[model samples]
Target: MSRSLKFALLITLRGFSWYIRHVTKSFLGRGQVPVIDSDAHVVETERTWEFIDGNDIRFKPVLASARSEPNNYRWLVDDKLRRRAMLSDIDHLRPVDRNTQTPEDAREMSDIQSRLNHMDQLGIDVQVLHNTLFIEQVADRIEVDVAVCKAWNRWLADIWSKGNGRFRWSCVLPLTSINDALDQMRFAKDNGAVAVCMRPIESTRTLPDIYFYPIYEEAERLNMAIAVHIANGNSAVCDVLRSPYDPGASFGMFRAMTAVSCHSYMVSELPQKFPLLRWGFIEASAQWGPWVAHEARRRYEASGKVFPDNPFAEFRVYVTCQNDDDLDYIVGYVGEDNLLIGTDYGHFDPSSEIDAISILKSRTDLSTSLINKIVDFNPRNFYAI
Candidate 1:
């Protein structure tokens, strides 16, 4: 067939297939894709600031762009600069409704009630919410980072209590001090946090760094999972995401690099050291599963090296996958129980093209039970929900 004809036929076939699926779902009364979105995001509003201590020169994250790099943001402690920068001619639409105009009026992420409404419309039963901007700003300020994490956790605890169990947050920790991070993890767990969010790739230190062992020991003690949500723009290796065409490309590359390193640690001494600890890598596509598993086996066979008994075990660690990832290959190597489905709802970045749960449900290779396992069961197991 000619190229133009082939394109036309492909479009026609896809449309026809979609129509058939739509009608079939309608007939079955399953039009809504029911899912517990394992990695959705929440935009922090003024509510996050409600509990922050004002006496200590406290910090709150704002989207500010430097005149030097007008397209990218430079997160700083000065809320004045953060706000003035936004008001002072930034590009694109502010992440708020134009008719409202008021910055606070457009805040969806900060308000748990408003966020729940969005979830209702999207048929999302649950969401594992991560911090929007604050996770990236705390570079070296130890005291400031600790206080901010505590305040945010306090605010989140209040919301979670009133929310009647709709939101689950990954509590941020100040890694500058091991003792302080442990204290925050315990505090967050006491306040009902699902997991402790941290950077998986420590650019300064390798995976087997001794400093991390204390935190892992504490997490295992508390039975709290460590969620390595992909850090963006201004990590150790990359100053900014720097992708003019696709920012998510840079984020994906970061996630992939971080995830592979994390897996290497998991397959080696880290998991063995803290045998009770559980780790999860989020926002990174899980298609890397097969490659990592392949490389892992290749090394073990080539070198006759020591290895874990069940190398593909899903109990200790988990990775989240997008709807379009290679499912068969992932399941083949990573095991279906180890796979999780998460749509980055409300995130401005590129994510799954369709409702992730629906895509899993429609997979020809996955049985109904396996689809349920990916959508609901795995996440529950991963997060201890």
Candidate 2:
């Protein structure tokens, strides 16, 4: 055979080999896959209590007041069914026990042992840990906000650093004040935090506006991605009243769907304002991506005169979808590059451990390279981890 014919044959053979390996691993389960869980939560400990203000009048009496009145946030949701749904269904899946476990034990279980066991079972190589209910569950508190955030970040840094490299942490910031948030971001970055974690809620006038450009500018300066996660906060209660019959079901379905569009709007505007800051919406399902992306494009195109800049330019938004979503439709519209596979795993359901890997392999269109990106590389790239 001539040299050119030999080269062509070699290229064809290489492509064939790539396809075979990819298929065998995905379908036949013949190859080892490195999984990366982009989203997971670690329960806080007494160390997390370090964030609480020992001196503040509101928090100083909380422990004693709890003994008398039990001022837990769970009590604020008055409706019994809604409260049960929030505590039983939602909290069950993502348990936050500030008692029971010591700081050392919490570290060993969540950061070290649980991750290792999960990786062994699910084939995950890394897990990114975010704050538990401290940020999301207790958002209504006005006094302990800054203190709780500081303590959370401190504990998070310690836990993440203890993991060596297997575990990564997204820093928690108090959006109650923009200057405080900026200071915390700098402190977090200096102390080895990869990303900042924020709840996806609108800001009030008393609090810093979400449009505070300085936070985005500082995040961009630090080369960090902001992880926006929506939880069953006070918003869940409002959702419950809106749909009384099956409140939990209605709220659960709509929160993730609504969060995508809300974040897309933020992504559209923030990027144009700062041009360098990247954002990722974590724990939100992938099903809404195509529609949200289409709407984003549509709205921008319709109001061309008012919005001259590309709405999605500064927004390198990565949607960390549930493992079981319609991967084909998601990958098709959003493209493989933008999707990250996040398993809100290791909570109550053991099935999450197994299903995480199965979900990735089930996607026929995903090549081994693309799978790798979704599993680990995408998160690392987005969060600078």
Best-fitting candidate, scored by TM-score? 1
Work out the TM-score per prediction: 0.76, 0.70
Model 1 CA lDDT for position 252: 56
Which 10-residue span in candidate 2 carries the lowest summed lDDT? 77-86
Per-candidate Cα RMSD to the true structure, in Å, reads 11.6, 9.8
Tell me how many residue pairs clash in candidate 1: 3
TM-score of model 2 relative to the true fold? 0.70
Q: Give the range where candidate 1 is weakest over 10 consecutive residues by summed lDDT.
A: 97-106
Sequence-dependent TM-score of model 1:
0.76
- Residue 360 in model 2: lDDT: 72
Encode model 2's per-residue lDDT on 77-103: one tens digit a residue.
112211211121233343242211122
